[model samples]
Target: MNPTELLSLLALKKAPLVGDILAKKLIREFGSASAVFEQDKPSIAALEGMGDKKASFIENKTFLFKKAEKELEFIEKHRIKYRVYYNDDYSKRLQYCPDGPIIYFEKGKIELDNPYVLSIVGTRQITTNAAAFLEKFISEIAPLNPIIVSGYAYGVDILAHKLAIENKLQTVAVLAHGLNQTYPRNHEAYNEQMMENGGFISDFWHSDSFDRKNFLGRNRIIAGLSEATVVIESASKGGSLVTADLASDYNREVFAVPGRVNDKYSIGCNELIKQAKAHMLTKTEDIAYILGWEKKQDIAIQKQLFVELNDEEKQVFKYLKKADKELLDIIAMDLQMPVHKVASMLMGMELKGVVKPLPGKLFTLA
Candidate 1:
């Protein structure tokens, strides 16, 4: 984009109450951010959801442009890279989100063209079990070469980035603050290594404040950038759950690792699975299967050669083989098994590469 248009977009983003959705709408209606700035008050107010007050705010661009100009200077001085929402280089998945930022800055060598981008999030106080699971999960899924995304915070987020680097996979850290500085101070150690392969991303400008509320905005970017979000562990309340909710709102697939009901960090994940908001993630294959990444031919080979199902799982396999696709309830009833028992068997069978889940609680042989 030209410097003139870029300045207008930055100023528009700084405008009070214009926000991402309305800013995008204004740009769409006016053909460009510069055009929106050139429009008269009457024309601006005439747009849907716009009023005299908002039009006035948008028209009063003097202060906004001053801030934008300062930010532009900072961008040039730091050699920071950025992506505009309408550009081809911006994240394709994030573009689908209505609230996605119109412009986001990046640092280091960041490439997001990978077909499979996965966001993994959890509590700051990650448990041993969750850590072990993430280590093994990243190693197993490394062969697929997905770009790993996470908040560059404590616990799960930082660990996810480290593991991705160790596995030689691209990993991007979505920050709550600006790319000019790292949060938590201690994590600055890994920044150099992370930027070598992955990098840092933030919508917050160099001048933006580092505040608690910024995390919500940061979480949206995390959720928006990926085809799926995985919650490895979370308490009943946390920022990771917020990311999961945003992912769901964007109509992206969500997965939660099942854990003992009484475990503190497992409560949120259990609730998500019980409420049917996310799939029950038992193993690495579950993600591949649910996202349709596992080819039928590949699964067929695994099923024929590697799978060794127990009696109950074998029963589910036989039933699904004949039924083609069957509901969970019907499978339990027809097989004279309890619903819970059948569900458990199906989960185990799915991990074994003999069964796959369909929409509306249906299952079929893989």
Candidate 2:
């Protein structure tokens, strides 16, 4: 984008109470960010969701525009690349998000055309088991050549980035702060390697101070960039869970690796499964199956067909084969089996590689 247009966007970003949604609205209505700033107060306030209070902020050109100028100078000096929301290079999945940033800075060679992208996130206090699971999971998915997205923070986020590097798959780190400096300081070790394939991205300005609250904004980018978000491990509450929720809000698939009930980090994953917010992820194949990453011919139906199924399990399987998919309750009702019994039967069948569970309590033949 030209400096004039970029400066306008930076100014829009600086406006108080003028978030991404509102800024984009103004831009769409005015035809350009520069035009949005040209509108009179009466014109700006005339739009829905805008009023005197909001208009005042947008009209604060004396302060907001000056800041934008300084930020633009920094961008030029650092030679950073930014993706405008309407640009072709912007994240395709993220562009559809209503609250996606109008522009975000990126460092490194990031290719958005990759067919598969997944975000792995979790608590900073990652457990040994979670780390082991991530290693094996990344290895299994390496053949698919998927892009990995994550926060560059410690624990699962850093682990996900490093694992993607080790597997030779591109990895993108969504930062909570600007590219002016790396947070945590210690992670500078991986910066050179990350830039080779994936790289760092953020919407924060060079002058923006790092804060705890920034993660919420950063997490949205991670969630928005991928077709699916996986919660490797999280406590009952954390930024990872927030990312999972954002992914669900975007109508993207979410998967969580289950841990023992009492495991602190497992609490979030179990709750997501129990609440039906995420599909239960047990093995790497679960992701492939749910995402339909595998071609029909690759599924070895012969092996599954030969796997013996009990009478009730066979009944469910037959119905599922005829129908594309079915809900858990519907299967129970149609088969005249108790819901609990059907649930148990389905679990056993899933283990036998004859059934697969989907989000929203749905099931399908594996």
Q: Number of clashing residue pairs in every model?
A: 0, 0
TM-score (all chains, Cα) for each model: 0.81, 0.80
- List the candidate 1 regions with Cα displacement exceeding 4 Å: 296-366
For each candidate, the alpha-carbon lDDT, in order, equals: 0.88, 0.89
RMSD each, Å: 12.7, 13.5
Q: Alpha-carbon error at 255 in model 2, in Å?
A: 0.3
lDDT of model 2 at position 113: 83
| Model 2 lDDT at residue 190 | 94
| Superposition-based RMSD of candidate 2 using all C-alpha atoms, in angstroms | 13.5
Q: What residue pairs are clashing in model 1? A: none
User: Alpha-carbon error at 5 in model 2, in Å?
Assistant: 1.4
